[model samples]
Target: MYICICNAVKESDIRDAVGAGVSCFKTLSKNLSLCTDCGSCGKKAKQAFHRALAESGASSNVVSIDAMSTAPVRRIQSTIKVSASATHHQKCIKTIL
Candidate 1:
């Protein structure tokens, strides 16, 4: 998927960069600039970063994906749910009056 249309940065581009030792967001921003422009693709870029890290055996850098994919097959496990609203840094949880 094309995460950054303005820069022509695809998800695979980010992944390959991650595999080549670009692990964290700071380095990713500096190296790939996937999230520096419009800011619309930041979240997806971050997701692709972590996925790339996990897939490339950078297990310590990526927690959530590793937890989901390589987690033990035990009886009970905790799952972290991230809402779309949260992705864009909006706190949408509300209370009824």
Candidate 2:
């Protein structure tokens, strides 16, 4: 069912956003832009959102600000090459091959 006609937001969209860890109205609005237009669907959308959260078993105590971000997560790769890991001053040619 469509919750917000202005933004074309549906009930599934709110549920999906909630499943993705959107715990508050701000994040839900940022993600779906649901109740930002004429404010008519605000109450319905909020109810659906809360219902979805309850159905999804999400706690109100936990918060995730990044849940609103659609950016893909990235990992930083790094490498360290130690020539000599010994405490001695001996000349050792250690290769990480």
Each candidate's number of clashing pairs is 0, 0
Which segments of model 1 are wrong by more than 4 Å?
A: 61-97
TM-score of every model versus the real structure: 0.60, 0.60
lDDT of 2: 0.62
Candidate 1 TM-score over all chains jointly: 0.60
> Which ranges in model 2 have alpha carbons more than 4 Å from their true place?
60-97
Instruction: Give the per-residue lDDT of model 1 (tens digit) for 5-79.
Output: 988999999888877866456667668776677889877887787778778887543323333555452311223
Task: Please give the CA lDDT of all the candidate structures.
Answer: 0.61, 0.62
